[model samples]
Target: MTKQYSLKHIRNFSIIAHIDHGKSTIADRLLELTKTVAERDMQEQLLDDMDLERERGITIKAHPVTMAYEAKDGQTYQINFIDTPGHVDFSYEVSRSLSACEGALLVVDAAQGVQAQTLANVHLAIDRDLEIVPVLNKIDLPAADPESVRQQIEEVVGIDASGAIACSAKTGVGIADILERIVTNMPPPKEPEDDLLRALIFDSHYDNYQGVMVYVRVMSGEVRKGSLIKMMATNKNYEVQEVGIFTPSEKPTDSLKPGEVGYLIANIKNTQDIKIGDTVTSQKNPAPLPLPGFKHISPVVFAGIYPVDSSDFEALRDALAKLQLNDSALHIEQESSMALGFGYRCGFLGLLHLEIVFERLQREFDLDIISTAPSVVYKCLINDGQVVDIDSPAHYPDPSTIESIEEPWVVCHVMIPSEFLGTIMNLCMDKRGSLEKTDTLSMDRLLLTYKLPLNEIITDFNDKLKSMTRGYGSFDYEFDNYRESDIIKLEIKVNDEPVDAFSCLVHRSKAEAKGRSICAKLKEVIPRQLFKIPIQAAIGGKIIGRETINALSKNVTAKCYGGDISRKRKLWEKQKKGKKRMKEIGKVSIPQNAFMEVLKTD
Candidate 1:
């Protein structure tokens, strides 16, 4: 706002909940009640800007907006709230959003009660010392049970929910109460001891005309136009070209003071110069110490991304660089393969994260790409006492020289109706998961805890869980300690040539079957050649499965019908010799279709 609000007048908070549990709807109601957006301009999912997020009905990125709400106490309050993603893979986004806020609104569905993600988000908010206000949504539904939900919230989440506000965001019932509570109940920003200009870069994006737009939360001091500031992480100094705040959209401001969230345009030429979580300070009088940054985001799943045409390699590289500007969780580096040629090995938080990134590359950047089989990060201890972390099977070390391999695992919590417990148990057991604990949240809703390898769930584990439960299952997981596991690398070879893109690591018990299935899929896709092609799956020197693609017949004996039998035999023998020479000297070419089909094999 143009008016400089004192520290006590400012309230910074965030909205946290499970996916598809009325987070966006509540956000719409807040915006409407506060008059942040006009009644005519108001629409659903006001913060979800990306089309992909709208189509998928989920928030992929955290969105922040500044509002000026006039409360019942006859005081104008400046409220900054971040709407965070609810999916487990985007928990990092939630963390970033929470760091910028002093409190949070924990929304829960009355019918669904306490789900897995609800508990996980509660823990995240608690760890950050955020003041949480539990709100019950969808009370207008016929099955709404607010009393039982409140009890579950208190007993299951260990939080006092006696004053939980019961409201339906869809119908605008009790929306005023939610806003009033945010202003009166949430704590104000802490007092800044000094005014040396220390602002944290919570999020950032690139603009073609303005370069990089750095989002900031001013902890102390003021940042105005033409003020020289230094990025604490990079130690680079730049003059602030402009400063502003987001009114659900960018609005230029004369200055941003303490306890305010806004953006800065510093004439930055490129996106790579700025890093999320870096502290901003005035170059003339910098802060005594920098703020604590966020923890490193380690990707759980990895896959290879290559352009369909070789000439588009440079475009692919540029596209990835641009993509990394907004998505800090995405990891990409140059990795070349003999079969797939030049590409990058990208890492993601989970399977959904991987899918979204791939889809964005195709849709946003208009680039055609081939994604290889996804794999998990493995820690291999060598015989010489060195540990190597590898995400791609091409990086796997020699089997004899490795002392042990440790695979990452997660503790998963699934909330479903009691009727689906048996089938859920069978599915987890099939994925090499072990049951750890089980509890009954309500009369019919049950929570099951299982320890499963991260590799198991990166595939179709979530899909199967939803299918078995008839779409009533809600899943969430957190990283556990790494442990040694019996895993082996399965490599695929066509015509005796190893293909790095098709290789994957599998457990020893399932290696043969995995290899066999891969071989079968490759056999159906690869085109026939003049010489017979052998598709083999192997571990080291031992071949476990093989499929042969028959060669095309030449029909060279068509004119030799009346000739001597010896002449026909001679022609056939000559042809056989030619085929052997071609098979020995010729190289096999793998098409893009073959790569897609084989890499997607389950």
Candidate 2:
């Protein structure tokens, strides 16, 4: 069913910025100004619908909404606004969101200027060929200096940022100016003949009632209700049951056309059916050019996720599957442990993504989870020409494997005030991070780059860095391949038994410090289940340090008022039963908190 529609009245764009740069707040103001969402209906960061995102005040996923605004020239245009996640962990999602836009609103905090993630996202936007409209956000703040921010943008990004709009998304100052620039500076959607129906799936989520709802940007034709569409990537076809537009509020529309962004409801049931960047075209006459798709995002960090109640494994799986539908970047698999029962091995882009997923799993689904310390994938070679990926501690090759092992390295960029440079540098060096270069971004700010092992960064490196800089520093890293290094495996043993799950790899020079810290933290967290538990970090059977949890004592004091002699005997029997129920205090194994102890680097 093909429908004809008028063209050239639509503009699609996305907002990109580092975390806490007022991206979501700016989007809210835009929605309010366009009258897409009512003034009274506005909530802080309305697009951040996830409970975890709301609580954390960070956008974890990209959300799309359509708004209509009449320009000062009396021309009305429909603007499809996409709000993207600012964290580096969601960089792939951000990139996909940008693909649907012709331009992006690059928001930078006037006071914070361009941080590490800001530079990373700006380069991504440039790579996608999206026109950038720089906006100096938070200008109303006392620390804001729009001129200095503009100079930083020009110097770092090489853009003529002289006329960048200075706006306070919180106060609505210069907001209209920002919107006007979006309309005038952003090019209208490209007009292509409706020869064949072609739409690009930038994002999708699963709905229990509607099945899979796909968010797509139509590139070359009309997609209407009951049309048969094929996902080019998977060669899967589905009949569109519904076509609609999102106002941040869903509204059913008869059809969607070229350059318009909207959603399609089909019988598609699985996320694998509609992958991000897959092209949807008419099964009868598909488009000739395949849509340009980015590489599949690979998770660089891995962690163990266990349900608080071992019986909740099924519930956890269901929750994770549902989350994965919207977040294609999240990966999970099932595994069993003698201690933790059934749990999952989850893959995440980085530490931030890992944290967000766990938070959402608990907050949204009400599934309490115990997440183990995060680890990065390591590549190792054995003496017999064998190579293996060590994602979990259990998979780590034995120390006697007799061949070299390489850990992933990253190029990290840290931006901090000049005063804390010495402290921050010392911390990085202690973590086996080598300073590669340092440059002054401003008279009082410095940008330092370090080549650090990915394993080190995956642990408490982030927390330590923030603490060292007094929370005034921002950092981002990208994998810079692997490097050969002198690495030592630190094994944790309990009761003379090696626990592979509690093992970690560290630089030989820092093994003693790292081991002692890990053991101490473990002692504080791992409770005495039934018996006292010994936490010892060892290298080649030689213990570096050890901590022991005292065995828990059980006390039973019950009344026996019955006059019957047999009743008194029964009471004594009941006391014995109670003692038996007290999980054999000396042999109870590990506690739930032990899994979380190693998560904190500091």
Candidate 3:
């Protein structure tokens, strides 16, 4: 059994940084230095347990582990740290992890220095009142300039980096100093146990053999096996079957005490029965109120997910239920499409978040699925002062509501080389974005702030920015507010029949061009039928763009070679009547591939 460390000797912290900033590498070195895992079991990115994370070279979830490190004072201390994702989409994961800690190690790349996401994460830490320790990583690279980066962090991030540790996480240089600083400079959890039980649920996952396992940090209580617990927000009670801490792997423990981060298992058959950010308390001696500062993060982007095969719908729903247990930000509801049949309309934080969930549904659940074009939540104000928020095009309210529609907007921060400033600004302007502020961080680097409609950024804007700046640009965004905009639904019609799956919301200024582009794409993919198929893009009752697929024909007059011209005319009339009748009642057979054609549209 592992020895138990007192609350005063335990330090809980998290590692936060920008994408590709060596955050995971620093985590690897820390695991090695603390001997958390045996030498034979130690590997690169040990905490990244998912195969997708290894393949993408990114951290998707926040991983927590307990490490026992003997300090120079000849005493062993329990260091509980969470390795968080650096991507902008997973900022919610970082925030939830930070709430369980008293401090965070703010790692900035020595070469790339501070980027957009670095500042965003630092603000999250500051909001939680966490002590931020600046650690300059990747100093072994040839372009490394630790001194300049320290100054950059101070000037740009406005953090005191005078005591920043300059280390190469790749070469294990100065790693020992980092650990020492964490133990000395960072403070331990100060929440005292007053015979009241309150454990904050940080994260969770589903297990088939056991049940729903919840990841939590004890703030001021102790929970052990056989302890009856109650979720304050949910008011659900369960008998604790087990309580343990993750030593890189689950290690069964006698009990979880205050200031320790651990997991608990009970009779939670359904993932929805437990709520994240809920306070867990002793059922017999429950707390009077839940913990403060629990904010429910809402999804900004919405899309429809349908199984490729109709039979896997139930499996898809079950897979999403399990995923929801792990991810609280993902919202799903039952929805159906005229072209795609039954599916789920899921809301995600961003495009990347939508994509990651889509990928996981396929990989983890072993299910084949297709998702529709993503849309942003639009608030519709009725003429009578009633408000309705719509995410799917099918759910859009009647246009004659006699009021304005409001679209969600975001404040986007972009950090890039000064040479690419003009191109970036022009690109943003093309996407209906307005420049708010431009600050020059250094002679080469510039930071530009832009306010843009959330719908504009959901497309290929990130790809365009990377291509234009040659991958040197860093981007981050936060929700601002809803503003009134002239937004309309762009519906696609095949043979005068509206395909609900192909419908989406578009801005008035770009509706005609967008409608034209989608019609052109559909014309290229949809197979030609015996009758003429007129593909049209429309807004309400007006058609904006059209494409025609000519009917395939075999000349009926060809069989009357050298016959009378009257007979040939008679045969042509018959063929024309048949074609007209076919066009009147023919059903447009839209294949599954036709549904994806709109999804891939730029």
Candidate 4:
């Protein structure tokens, strides 16, 4: 016999926290307490099923599961748990995931207290007006102090601290109490009249055999197999061939109703037909108002994406387009470069998002990619009274034609041990970061805020901060506004010819050192050919400094074999042919690391 519960008795919620803060572990413990999976079949962080995600110990995507738990009163209730990604890279995805939930479980590390990302995610939950159930996780660790963490959450987030739960998601202690709190505190979904069919698409993915699979939160609709549906956003209609609820691993039902979260399979061959924020309604009794949707996320970071093998251009385009179907945050367009061949101009939310996209392309699609340095969008006003938006160095307006240039800035928060405060402050100063304020989080810990140029954050700032702090510092930033600043245009010349592919704009004070370091790195990696190469950096037309790469030369008349004169002559002839091939290398123009080394300047 199997257990069954009505829609009114179900509670759909998501677990959110900072990275490595035990959100997934707590989810696993919840599953165990409810006997959702057999005890012998348990695994660590079970929701992170992807091999990459498991290795990294982070959840890259949102996953939903259903379980039935019996309370002390001898009544069974269905719980639909959603595990969301904890990094800022997936913040937009987290927002979309929250739309399918009535509340969220905010997990905080008892030993570490609240981190920058922890506060950021908690604020996001509050903005959505989702009921928050705070949990102090990792109570079994040696440094665990649940009382202090509870106080911090109350003071920082301005929430009631009386009902906070303390539990070791690892040892299963206090797990039952956490479950009881969920049933008592979290509100049930408000039932709709069911007079019209309406549902909000929160997430979606493509399947090779099943076409587009959309995950929706039913608001006022009842949908079943063999129903005709219309997408209000796209004005396209389709026949729903199958419908079922997500069982953490798979869909195992034939229909879904109001207050339920489930997946619907429509015979819409193209994945683009089903967008993340689109609305699905019955073709006969469509609702008057469209489902509440979020404004599309505009990318703040831009970069050039190229395949290591130029022949894979089409494959790369197809792969990115497919990824964009599932990820609305990824934006791509056709881009061409004489040096890089045909590629793409892709936009991302941040640096981590950029890295993840490149990694997925190489791992999932089996394609090799060469990405240029990531850059932020710059707002410029031309001398002709025209406003221009520049995302790439190629699109930067000529200095002579610009009236003023404004660069994006961010409000940055950094938390570190007090002993390393001086080192971090020096780093911030060197990167043009202006300190806003500093406060003590504990006796030996400090929280510092800075207003820094976005250009600095796009460089190696994150890695350098971690390295200087011995991996103990945590930081996050949000776009504040733009400020007017003095800027300089850096141009690189090869063999006394200006190379558009090696040009960039940087702050005036840092231009000289940046130029020298870039040229030095280029001289080391670019291979010599039949002719020597001259690398130079310039402000306008006059060269500042230069480095030369000597051409290769060798002796061809050294050896002969016993009566094998023809073979030796053939070998020498091949060497002459190699010299001709070397000519192509000399004309290659750009260094192998030219694009990457320039972007490394902090």
Candidate 5:
């Protein structure tokens, strides 16, 4: 029989660190050390279940698993480990995971030392007042220096690392010491008052066979199968069909009490009914107040996602619906474009989130997609004194509307080696980033703070920073505020008609260069027709840049037998007339790949 432990013996914690800092590997080691999974069935990155996540070597989602560990003090304890994604795109998910836990394992690489994301996650954990256990990973590597990293963590992260655990998840060294620290150092879940049931839903997903599966950290209640549960945020009730805990896989349990982490299935057909950070309680005896931090999340980045083949529109919609069941960060709305036809404009937290959603659609749903250039929400003040929020170029009003445009700005924190300071500063200035301050951590490392336009960093900022620094730089940012900027609506005209889908908002200084680049790329991608097709980038009625696709010459007299010289004229006139007719009626079909090329700025 499975050992049942009281709330005081249960320790709920999450693993947080920088990207590629061995969070998943450490979680895998914990699973093995506790014998949660048989050694014969163990695999690398065992907690990263998604193929995309494994292939990319990043944890894209947060996963929770339960393990029974015997402490050094000889008490059998139940430990719930919530593995969170380290990317800034999924930081909201990480916040939810941290809110559900009482402690966190702060993993840092022995060689790489502290990174940007490490500090970001550390601030989040500290905000939640969670007990932090510092761990230095990858001690088996030749460049590993645990003592130096411990000092860095203490000085930079402002955490006491004297008792930090050093371990190599790859070689299974010091695994037992880490487990013993978890058992003895990390505090257990705090006891709740004797009140009605209330469980916090940190994560949820739609299961095809079982309906809505909600992952809950029971706070003050016990729930079981057939219990009538209500979501406080939505105020909707459902009969609990099943309840279980993840032993890597869902295992049914009789009931989940306080301090336990598990999944509960409620017969919910609509995925919109359950949201992350919601409070689940008993209908018969509800709590007086709902749990804190239950609020709707809003998306910052927006893009239009269209199926390459218009016939797959419904298929794409269905796929998005299913994906949204698990990722509530994605927001979608129905939209149409004259050039791209029908599609949904989707919003995300960041560029990484957008890329992951696109990959999932292609890989999991077998859908070929064309995504437009990502945009940030812009606040426009119109002549009528009404403020309009615009996320797509299709919705941009005419310039004659006499309005000012405001774009979102972010406070970016970049940590890099001090040697590349000049190069990074120059690059940031080119992107319109204004330096606010700089902090010197040591002789070799520095942290740069800048206020940058959100539009500047959405595309290839991170990639370029890595390229310039030789992959030693890391960054994190948060939305600061919207500021007024001199911006204009840039449009691409094919022949004489403007393509709505290719329109975008650009700053006054970059309007000419951006337009020239787009026109040049369009010239290369758009195929030459019978008549010369001119591609022009225009701001209002003035053309700023232009390119032309030369017409393919035809041998009009190749098939003619000699008669009078007038016969040649007649044939030439006929050919010219035909060409004119074709030019008038012929429409250029922009291939899906061509649209994708136009969106690739870097």
Candidate 6:
């Protein structure tokens, strides 16, 4: 028989940590100790069901599972684990996860110490006023220094770690102690009245058999099977077909009571009807007021997603529609590229999110897609006192109509070793980062804060940081505001015809070098034709950089070997004239792969 817990016995908490800090591994061990999954069914990262998630060793979606455990106090308590993505790109989802829980398991790596994401999540948990229980993971490793990490957490994170549980999720050692700490240290949900239905949709995903399945945390009343429920945000109603909890898998339940986390499936056909963070209530006895919802998150990075073959345009759109049902952060619109054909201009939280979405489109849907260079939305103020937001390069307005442009800026925090301070500062400066402040966290560690352009950090910033710091440096960033800058639209022309795929907004100072680099790369990718093709990078009417792809050489004199010298000269003259005429009229056809390669350059 399934065990039941009262409101006081239910502990809703989430695991928050840095990427690759064993959050998933710890979740697996928790399931084992609680016996939520049978020993025969045990596997690594059991909750990460997606193949791409396991292969990448990262959590792309937020998952909540309930487990019944008998603590050292001889009391059976129900625990709901909200597993979240560790990367900064999904911090908004992490925030949503926190709001659904009463406490958090602040997992830290014993060897890696406190990272940028660790600090960022800790602050978020604190802001939510959730009780935090610090846990030191990977204690079985040879390099594990639990005591050192504990002290660093105390100093940097401003949390008392003297009672932090030290254990290795890999070996399952000290697993029992961690569970005990969760029940003893973390506060349980308050007693909820069984009056009106007030459930929050924390996360959701689409089910082929069940349609849209919403993962909700019941705040009050109950959601029972065969009951009418209404989404307070969308004002859409549905007949609840079933309600269930995740024992790492969706197990059907009769009803989800107050202060419990579980799934609710209705006959809802449209994915647009369900909104994340919206409140779900019983239509019969609706709650007086809906729960506070989260702020609408906007995309930080914009890119054009075009199918390799134009025939798959509809398939790509359908795939994105299904994917967006699970990922609320993705934003998309219809876009047409001159070289790439019909496609969508998509916006993502960050570069990783963008890559993950594309990977899913290819692996899950089996569609070939080409993504243009990732760009940020620029706020353009025209000379006629009009403001416009440009998300795609193709939509960039004429430069003659613009007066000024404002680009998004971010406040970044970098935690690094003191010795590499000089190297990192110079690297940040090269990326247009301005140092705001610096602090000595410890004898060996330093924290540096900078105000940088969001565009600068979205592309390969973290990878470059790891490269310079030998993989020891960590950083987190948040949007600060938009700042006016000297920005210009960069357009690439092949044979005097503009290619929309090779257009972007760049700062005026770096336009020359960037244009030169782009033109040089085009010269390499664009195939040699019957005539020399001139590639030019132009801003407005002024050409900043240019390159020429030499035409294919022909042996015009080969057929005149036995003829006189005049015959050979005439053949050469005819070839030159023909080449000149072809150069004037020949249209450069950029292959799909060539457009993909050119965008990847620089």
Q: How far is each candidate from the true structure, as Cα RMSD in Å?
A: 2.9, 7.5, 2.2, 6.5, 3.0, 2.7
Q: Per-residue lDDT for 1-602 in model 6, tens only?
A: 36668777888999888878899999999999899999999988888889988998889887888999888778899999988887788887788788889999999999888888888888889998999999999988899988888989898889899999888899988889878888888888876765788898888888888888998998888888898999988888899999999988899988898889999999777666777778898888888888874566788899889889999999999999989877767888998867788999898998889989999999999999888888898999988998999876666888888898999999899999999999999989888999999977777999898999988887778888999999999899888999999888888899999887888888888789989998998888888999888999999999999999988989988776585799988889999999999888888888766776777775
Ranking by TM-score: 3, 6, 5, 1, 2, 4
Taking all chains together, each candidate's TM-score versus the true structure is 0.92, 0.87, 0.94, 0.87, 0.93, 0.93
What digit string (tens of lDDT, one per residue) describes model 1 on residues 1-602?
48889999999998878877788889998888889999888888999989998888888877789999999999999999877778888777677678788999989998778888888878888998988999999999999999999998997888899999999999999789988999888899899998889998877888889988998899999999999999988889999999998889899999999999999999887666777778899999999788875555678889889998988899999998888877767889998988778999999988889999899989988998988878999999999999999888878999999999999999999888999999999999989999999988888888899999999888888899999999999899988979899989998899998887788899988899999998999889888899999999999899999999999879999988695799999999999999999999988888789887876677
lDDT of 4 by residue, 228-319 (tens): 98999888988898887765656657567777777889876776666666789999888887867555668889988998788999999999
How does candidate 5 score on lDDT? 0.89
Candidate 2: residue pairs that collide? 460-601, 530-584, 530-585, 530-586, 530-588, 531-585, 531-586, 531-587
Residue pairs whose backbone atoms clash in candidate 5: none
What stretches of model 4 exceed 4 Å from their correct place? 1-8, 39-41, 252-254, 383-386, 484-488, 527-533, 542-545, 548-602
Model 5: residue 498 alpha-carbon error in angstroms: 0.4
**lDDT by residue for model 2 (292-343), tens:** 8646677889888988798898999999988888777788988876667889
TM-score of structure candidate 5 = 0.93
Better of 2 and 6 by lDDT: 6
lDDT of model 2, residue 394: 69
Query: Model 3: clashing residue pairs?
Result: none
With a 3 Å backbone cut-off (N, CA, C), the pairs that clash in candidate 6 are none
List pairs with backbone clashes in candidate 4.
none
Q: What is the C-alpha lDDT of each candidate?
A: 0.88, 0.82, 0.88, 0.81, 0.89, 0.87
The positional error of residue 53 in candidate 1, measured at the CA in angstroms, is 1.1
* Cα lDDT of model 3 by residue, 187-294, tens digit: 988868486888998777778888889989998879999999998877899999999998888888999999999999998987776666778999999888887766
| Candidate 6 segments whose C-alpha is farther than 4 A from its true place | 1-3, 551-577
